[model samples]
Target: MSGRFDRRVMVVTGAAQGIGRRVAELAAAEGARLVLVDIADYVQGVAADLRDQGADVLALQADLEAWEGAESVMARAHERFGRIDILINNVGGTIWAQPYEHYTPAQIQKEIQRSLFPTLWCCRAVLPHMVDQQAGVIVNVSSVATRGLMRVPYGAAKGGVNALTVNLAYEYAGQGIRVNATAPGGTEAPPRLTPRNTEAQSEQAQAWYQRLIDQTNAHSFMHRYGTLDEQAAPILFLASDAASYLTGTVLPVAGGDLG
Candidate 1:
């Protein structure tokens, strides 16, 4: 259990699946004590698996988009672990990818809630403990789609995440807290058991989604989607002492497509 994050208490949001789940697994393998958070019940299963492998882990089901939920998660983590060493804000996704005009007011609001508020709320919730300890690391999951996308609302939300990272890093660096972000490119992972959007999509909507996928690949120098590990590695690096000198930087893991 001796590794870069040995004895570190790390909280990873959106830990039910995809890049978030991968981050949890990799971090656990590297000796991090994990607090895995998600709105999905499946997050418990992830924690159980890690525990079976002899990792110290806790899983909490909470809606990170709400301030109360974020507060509860951080409070519980502090109560259990006695310190907040790392926070990876990974809860976000594009629910619907279409032209800006096609998005209704509700849809636009939901997009912002889904892709931005969780990170915002979680950062605010965790900062008090981190600042009190005068030491912590935060790696927010941003997206290259910020510049190339049919999902304008989602892009805007991730843009906010990048801004949050820079400003937070600037504000807290003197206190020994580091804040950074990883803007992942198009990534390949399994289909979600629970899709981000459960509503049926129309043919036009599907076409717009395809355009997003096409443009993502076209804009990448690799001309292909990155693997989940490819995306998670940089996140872990930023969370580890290996990146001790890094702060307030947004590293783009987009195969040369800097967004």
Candidate 2:
């Protein structure tokens, strides 16, 4: 409500649902001009709802798994807004929950692709514009599963995200760009309209997923999942100028799990 983002041009990826949707809503409410991107068609409806509330918003449908998709999203943001002040890379999730040895090579690659490539591509695409402008902020959504999970590939990908955040912050500090990440614990939200995996999961897979949930709750001091707002607030904080002194940091919103 403080309008920390007044007049700011912000982009949020994976904005069709869940954490990304919450981020976009909050940012818009706080006075950001937004570009919301998602491969899902639901993103258009999200944008429309914001528009109804008088938010300046652009909804883009793109597959962020490829470099071109990332490039196009950034290009449109710049072309429409003239500059990008913030970017929230919220485009990732664990597609499968199974032991490492149980994962096939194809499954491993798909997991990596789902949970890593989008962030990597978006960062690579957005940097040139930020570097040229000499002012920007990037908030990557990571996960506490890095240290506890049945989803090893997801954990590894998030670990890579943490590393990317630190190094990018250091690399672009002189250019007035700040990069940080948030590692959220298990979160409670509505059932997804579009599930992460389309294939029918076997009984073993269901048990593995349950193990992931149990491990997540057990690792957290709160002993429960986080609300959407709990996860989004820290991301907005990192994006705002209030955190001007903080960069190259991965703040954990994991109820003391500190992954």
Candidate 3:
């Protein structure tokens, strides 16, 4: 497990915390030259912390939902590292939990913006460089919620991620690029440093969120939430040479939930 990456240039988005941060940390342990990116300035603090521990890291803040931001991130990564060997597209999360009908038009749009376009735009932005190198790995963090509970828009966005993974793998295999995704079920991590939603939760909203929790646990064979390491390990596997023969597959990291 040690030194598996051995200085491979890797980019991990949404790397300020959680699964993304874990991936970057583990990869660094294995000798990856990391480019950590997030929309929050706090990602710089994350990078600084990792540097203190003797990792080669460059952290950037960017809104990957926009093309310019995505393009700039990849461009800077390439400029600094010279070649990109792996990309872990780990941005996106559900901001609201409710019945589809309860969501406003703006909320739906934001869900798509938050959960879909970042992966879409980043994939598009990185493909050319990946193609030029003719070898790369992409592991997108999708969700098992694509089949469970109150985040219909988020589910749909992840569905798009699934489709994109398959099609991109088909198109780019000849160029030695592998694209895949991991669908994580309920994960138990620390509270977000920056909450995705700042609005106070109403009783109805709280109930709606509870339903999501119930359904997630009910469907998982383990009937439990997984730890951060449980989720991060599979993602790193998909991004590693250990998965050399794997491509275009969405591996479910949920104990038994296939979503």
Candidate 4:
């Protein structure tokens, strides 16, 4: 593809699988040198496969929940690639769910760390490099759950992502940095969603989970879950120069399912 991102150094977190993996592959195909970071042990294998395809790729196993992890990833990217032109903060996931009274303090904290803190840490780590270069793109991955009613913790964390995107855009827009987010609808993909509806052990609880899934699938104009690639497309586009003039916006790729 003929585009502005050719050979640009790009870092994608949560890249071991799912939306993050697809985003990395597509970015690499577009001629970006990639630093794929994920806490998951499988990131090395994914990096190996991409390298075999002749892409300049590096894989780092890091828990982005730690501030150090975010710093380390950025430092490695600079050490290996010389500069960062795009940073896709694709970390975070739905780590926990429960009624408000049912969640412990520990569980609440874990969910926030899992679904929000990494984005904050990575953004903090990359902003200076972007400002120093006088140019960069940041694509934060949020969730459609933020659009309306959904799981309390996941939705709250994603809502924070949207807030962060807007604030960063305003603060960095004059500095030549673009910040935006993609909120993908629930997907029928592993680690994203699953075929197992009864992961909850209780019969009543499992039934409740199934009902939630059903309602979510029906919320979209298209009554089906999106594929991983489908969810990753907007994120990749925002990470590329194709979206040069876009920032501070949340693009929902939920098949029009914001209801």
Instruction: Give the per-residue lDDT digits (tens) of candidate 3, residues 1-259.
Output: 2487988999999999899989988998888899999999889998998888788899999999899999999999999999999999999999999999999999999999988899999999999999999999999999998898899999999999999999999999999999999999999989999999999999999999999999999999889999999998999888888999999999999999999
Question: What does candidate 1's lDDT look like per residue over 23-77, in tens digits?
Answer: 9999998899999999999999999999999899989999998999999999999
Weakest 10 consecutive residues, lDDT, candidate 1?
A: 1-10
lDDT of 3: 0.93
Query: Measured by C-alpha RMSD in angstroms, how accurate is candidate 2?
Result: 1.0
Q: 1-259, model 2: which lDDT tens digit per residue?
A: 3299999999999999999999999999999999999999999999999999889999999999999999999999999999999999999999888999998999889888978889999999999999999999999999888998688888999999999999999999999999999999999988997999898999999998899889888888989999999999999999998999999999999888997
| Per-residue lDDT of 104 in model 3 | 99
TM-score of 2: 0.98
Best by lDDT: 1
Models sorted by TM-score, best on top: 1, 3, 2, 4
Q: What is the TM-score of each candidate against the true structure?
A: 0.99, 0.98, 0.98, 0.92
**Model 3 Cα RMSD, 1 decimal:** 1.0
